[model samples]
Target: MAHPTTSVLCTELGFEWPDGTTVLDGFHLAVGPGRTGLIGLNGSGKSTLLRLMAGELTPTSGTVRIGGELGYLPQGVTFDTARQVDEALGIRAAREALHAIEAGDTDERHFTAVGDDWDVEERARAVLDRLGLERLGLDRTTGELSGGEAVLLHLAALLLRRPDVLLLDEPTNNLDRRARSLLYEAVASWPGVLVVVSHDRELLQHVDQIADLRDGAVTWYGGNFAEYERTVAAQQETAERLVRAAEGDVQRQKRDLAEARVKLDRSASYGKKRAVTRNDPKVFSGKLKRQAQETAGRVRGMHTERLTEAKERLTAAEDAVRDDAEIRIDLPRTAVPAGRTVLHLDHVRLPYGPRADLELRGAERVALVGRNGSGKTTLLRAVAGELTPVEGEISTPVPLRYLPQRLDLLDDTLSVVGNVKRYAPAVGDNAVRARLARFQFRGGRADQLAGTLSGGERFRAALAALLLADPPPQLLMLDEPTNNLDLASVRQLTQALAGYQGALIVASHDLPFLRGLGITRWLELDGTLREVDPM
Candidate 1:
């Protein structure tokens, strides 16, 4: 059971843009203890609402109340290039406090300020161990750590603060399978209030409740993402039925108004004829005209009311069930000769800077599965011709598209359109625009700077460029293509790949994703690459 004190409440909150356009209105959310997942499509005010909860943004008209201390881990953290993990963990502060105590300078002021008298090194080591960084060198520069490692370190630091309420935004974005599992385990065991925003279906399944943000309001559900999805489907069906019924009512009302208008017209013509006859004709005509006018007014009022109600019903139905179009890649057609081996490695081995062979592989849809720094990415790069082989003959087709795990191919300085045009000139502007639209970029967004785009947007941009290239490659190599992608986008990519007729070598720990794609074979990269049967 959750404690009553550990709760978050929002009341009739609203937000508007600088142009007086509403982004979120009449919003209310109640988050109780236990893990709650926040979900929505991009630009649906999920982030804005999170900021409001964290007290980083003020609501325009309503109040947000958090019952306890709040701690937040933003979507991504900025690491100090010069600092190491130990430095980031406040080892210096710990050391200073320790030294003061050891020097027999334990004044009340110093002791109160320091808070502890334990060895700083031991404390730091303990914290690092809990975060799975015990073996990592304290002196290692932060700049040298991989993106995934950096994220873990930042998370460890945040946990050290021991906040009562933890707000995490896409915490699993760059994490590998092992790291993600560790994070899930930690959150599950935590006793504080947790509000997380993520699109990973697997991660979301662990949450206690799902708060779906759509059309500027939050809908609460009692189960995981799958349950929420089912609920949404049912609600959408009901809304569609209501909308259709409303339309029928509107049509019926229109017909009734038309009939009434016809009756009034007939009555007027009858009165006009009597007025043309003689004696007391004016009085009779006036009475007939007054009755006609009254009928007309009633008919008009009823018609207006019916139309307004119908329109409102339709709008409500549309709002209840917004369409999320899965992103589909329009891969350029290419001629890949059948039975022509696209990639072959004969007794190939991966060496770590003059060390013995670390991993070996053969031709297959080999999933390099391991923890971070397990050399999965290195193997992919070696196959892609980016890294030279140390001891074997590696052969691949001339044009292979390699999507790195971290989308490093994008030029940060270039605009989205510029990058596409430069890398894939054969794709004309119109075609490029169409492809971008499939990925949900439209209007001026297609022209925005790539550096300014969000993680999801950047992934879409990279995929767009890959598909637009002239002479599409026969072999598609991807390292964790599902990372940071929303569920809908992942489905889109999976569907596109399902229809693709090419060799694919992907390294991802997303077991469900790999199975969903129906990968033909598996290559396990542990010490030596060996073919393993898929589970």
Candidate 2:
């Protein structure tokens, strides 16, 4: 069904940070009923756009209009620990009023509060159940839930609202496979307008359309993520062909202009010789020379204009081609011998999971997969020495580093280069910069503050720091590394990893990325770790 004209509309919208960094300018968008996947590179204002539509942010210029009530789910969900589940769902007052009426306390205030939501409790429970939160009673505190559970609970609240328009930003970043599936089911059945900004390919597959945000403009494509990819591939092919044609045109124009100049020179020479041989009157010769010069001027002007237009066309065609750089580096120091044992775990018991044992050797790559609320993060933390195991032993004989999902390892006050220096204090400034260049942080970008970097840039900086530490990590543990990365950046990361000769353990829900890693083993972490062929 077609939504109202104002379901979610932005007219000449613009936004800029306090530091005068423009996120969006003169942006115009109108979304109707159906799912739309808003995708863009990191720092391209996907999240900012969602905030503007949800009224969490005011645009610097223009306007945002919503025809009906709107619901928003941000990347992170924060709430008071003591708040009850019903309160978070926004049905506490109505539920309380209904309870009072049931208890025979027919106060006028209670009757007024109950109003039209007499079944608010039942609806809230239904939403919770749909999101796999059936065990979470209305009395449960927010603090009792895990990170993934908290995100799901917030989404459940939004679902209960039944808004005319809903906005979700990176909704599946914290979710596991099961939680993601539940969310996808909910999205597929959404009755109102839905807009999602995410990097999760699986979630994007459920979208009815793709809205690609690039260079401050939105390009709409009809169909799911797969269809969008096919369309973009075809467009890129056409663009490359156009670029080749434009290049040929410019070359031809240059040749024509050169030939025209030569011809004019020859014509002028011939006229001069003929004038001398015929001994024409001085006035007639002068007029002939002036006329020849004017004709030459017009010819040159016409050729120059054609050449200029051809060059302009070439530039436009080149602009249509994307040139996103990839990460390429050699990490010879990170290599380990085939028989080297990087990590060994003997009946390790984590805080919330069962005992597990593991032995990693050489440059083996392992993928850790599990559902939400599982102890995947916990296990990685224990190995990284961030958390203490309840029982048994864990050992890492060589240098190790962990890149957590939050990416809080780097100091915000330091520059990108400075952060790397912090990790590899012995490396010289010039050497550090040369190494960072491989991560795509060159020149002034290396000097930029960590706090000011975008999501993708920050991830690159963190990876550089870890891989280039004082004693290069032989065992690198990454948690959801592709969470906020654009497709181009993800490819860059995969290419970078191809050069790392170390034992790698990555915990992620991104199947495509794991498949690209050439994983030697896949371990599913439920209560215990077990080998599984997820592929």
Candidate 3:
């Protein structure tokens, strides 16, 4: 159903928010065949651009020319949980018709539904296999699948459309390692024009090029995310060096201009004394003074121009340098002595999932890795006292807190300070304000409603509540802490975790992030928890 043009073009594209916030200004882009990875910070307009291209949003003052059929998979995919997988794939009617004819129920309407492409079921299964969903039954309701599985299911449906242009936003954010591998294979085999907006480094590595959106502009880099990172790293290094050279040049120009002025003053004074001592003619003395002033003005102007140019160059160079600020915090009284037993679980059993025994001593940093539905989240919830084990003896020597993936710990309607105060009722308003400021919520920012906060801000607010609790949780558990976070925010979280002197068990699929946390133990949950070598 696609035209022969097979190209996507945005000519002088412009878009703006209803609140008078300009998201994109005069952005132009031309995308052709092959996979293109669109990447940027959390709010760098990557999603906005995708929406514009998908025709879900109309550009305020530009034209979008798509010369082919399109299919879009949004960041948050929702489906009718009651619908079967076949229904979700848009093939239930065709499949039913095919089965009806085989059963000898010769209805003319059923024949029409079959059409020419009678292998809809085969094609559907193939796509599901490609996306690691072959194990999921076509007749099963969508509610039966896990969160990661649900995301893969939607992607499978999109791929079955066979569109000339495919737009995906953070498709791999919820996928596990195995599912990610399958998605990577699909990307590698894709032949049409593919454009995906994602922060997953592994997923971006499969792209033919990377489109970096920053400051309302798209900068193209050849090759994948790795190549983009290398290119930017090289540029920043060169930029920093140029800045240093420019600064030196400006200082030298300033010194030269001052020296020239001093010489000119001395010359004028010497000429005046000479004209008076030699009894020179008045006209000759006047001409000499005029020449001296003219020459000094020219010298001063030249140096001033050089200094101005140097300053301009310096500013441009400095702009290219990265200035990622680190998060710093103090977690007082959250420390556990080296020999203390922080947690002990004896034959702990969840209502569903593997029964296991575990223990945490002192300030051990544990990395919990597992596939979706493997009970990683359930275990964390049980530890946080949100859920009780069906049967087992679990003991905790200190206060514990859990940060779920949804970040529902804070009330959206309340201010960030109000949420933190809920956990620390005894702490006065002044003390709470002081603590929130350390979490980067200073003054009026601390008074902003949790619902109005950005993704990173909301995460920080939820974390602050846990940290400022009355008992000061000595054991912390986080589930997919880096999900949907920008790179800078991930770094900020790493820095914040570095300051927490407590027993930590973090369940996440981000291996790089777990390594950054300095994890002392690695636990994989399949049917049971087992400590494994990180390598």
Candidate 4:
């Protein structure tokens, strides 16, 4: 069946703060009944516009019209600790209400009399099956569920509400590859109007259209992420050409104004001498002065107009290249030769409850691929010397750098540059500033408190500190490095890893990223670590 006409229209929308500061201005958008991917840099008003569409925030100056009911999933979910998966889905309440209505015991004042025919249990089951939670134990506590499982459960609950439109913000942050694939599949088949705010390039490829938000305005494109990128590149080139042309025009205008001023000065000098003389020999001195003044005024006006035009063109060009500078950072350099044995594990056994053992090694770029709490991070910790082996001796080399899944090594109170200096004291201030510049931390940003930095910025700072040590690490260990990174940063990091010569042991569910980095070995963690042939 065709989907309903669920759309949103925002006309001349303007949102401001209490201090009379405008964040979004003259923003016009038309959201049709299809998948629309919203793309922007951080703090670009994507989240705010989504909330406005969901009716959570009213626009300060314009109207937002929603054609139908809307379902929203914010960047994070707040779970009720006391509620189970099923109870959170409202399945129990729906069941009881249906039962009461069918048994003719429901309050007539509370429920409409459309009662006994409703198949609430069957409907709930259908929705659960569609969401891949049909076989799950509904009474399982929310606290016990893994990150991906909890996300799927909450999504199921939201789908059960049957809203005409759905809005999701960064919905794939903690999802593994399997979970992400499942989500994309579900959203692809969903029959409602969907607006997604995300920086994941792969996810954006699945949408029908892209709405790029930049400079407080939205520009629509009729294709996926790849097409959008190509269009933006072309636009940047055009803007650069315009900037050059404007500069040339300004230079020409300046030359013309100078020549005109000289001519006017000569004319006035001659006219003044003629007026002072007793013999009125000039044909028309008054006309000559008036004409010189008009010419100078016109030249001045042209100069002002050319300068304004040049500045406007320069601003456009700068904005076009602003987002391109972020993906240029160099990864930590490692001089360790390739194919060297950085670490080895023999007969290693890690216990899980009572009867399981997990083994891992540094011989492969192993992806601890499984649901959360499946000993992936635990295995990495063991290799990093953060956790001791319970039975066998785990061999590891000295001068190894381990980037934990969480940036716990960074001191929150210290500035970014201060943290780097403290961690690697031998690095000079100038060298540290230069390295920070590669990571897009120039000017006063390096002096900002580490706690105030965003997740991506913190990750960059931590990586900078790790790589800038006196002697570079011979082995590199990273856990979920791509978790909070935007797509461009991930690409840049992957390229840098491809060039690194050190031994690598990464624990990530990002399959595409691993493949791009030329990971050649695989270790599956079941009860033991057994090497498998590379894919």
Candidate 1 vs 4: which has more TM-score: 1
lDDT of 3 by residue, 1-535 (tens): 2235547888888998764557788888888888999877655677778899998999999888887788888866767889999999888998999999999999999999989868888998888887877788889898767778888888888788888899988787667789888988888788899998876788888999998877888889999989999999999889889889888988988898889889888988999999999998999989988998899889889888888888888888888887655678988689989788998989988868678789889999999988877888888888778888988988988888889988888898899999999999999999999988877888988998886665667888899899889889889999988876767778888988888999999998888889999999999988878999993
> What order do candidates take by TM-score, descending?
2, 3, 1, 4
Q: What is the C-alpha RMSD of each candidate to the true structure, in Å?
A: 5.3, 2.6, 3.7, 6.1
Which portions of model 3 miss their true places by more than 4 Å?
Answer: 1-6, 264-298, 328-333, 410-472
How do the residues 1-535 of candidate 2 rate in per-residue lDDT, one tens digit apiece? Answer: 2245548888899998776778889999989889999998777888889989888888999989887888999876778899999899888888888899999998999999988888888888898989999999997888777678988999998887888899998888878778889999999999888999888888899999999999999999999999999999999999999999999999999999999999999999999999999999999999999999999999999999999999999999999997788889999999999899999999999997667899989999999988877888899999999999999999999999999989999999999999999998988999999999999889998998898777788899999999999899999999999877888889999999999999999999888999999999999888998899866
Q: List the residue pairs that clash in candidate 4.
A: none
Q: Over all chains combined, what TM-score does candidate 2 have?
A: 0.93
Residue lDDT tens for model 4, 168-242: 887776676667877888778878889998767778888999997878888899888899889878987887787
Per-candidate clashes come to 0, 0, 0, 0
TM agreement with the true structure for every prediction: 0.77, 0.93, 0.87, 0.73
Which residue segments of model 1 deviate by more than 4 Å?
1-34, 45-70, 76-82, 95-114, 117-127, 137-146, 222-227, 250-308, 329-335, 346-366, 391-393, 411-415
Model 2 residue runs over 4 Å out of place are 1-4, 264-292
**Residue 404 deviation, candidate 4, in Å?**
4.6
Ranked candidates, highest lDDT first? 2, 3, 1, 4
The clash tally of candidate 4 reads 0
**Candidate 4 ranges with C-alpha deviation above 4 Å:** 1-32, 48-68, 76-83, 95-128, 240-323, 327-333, 337-341, 351-374, 385-393, 404-414, 418-422, 425-431, 449-455, 469-473, 495-501, 526-535
| Pairs clashing within candidate 3 | none
- Model 1, position 425, has a per-residue lDDT of 77
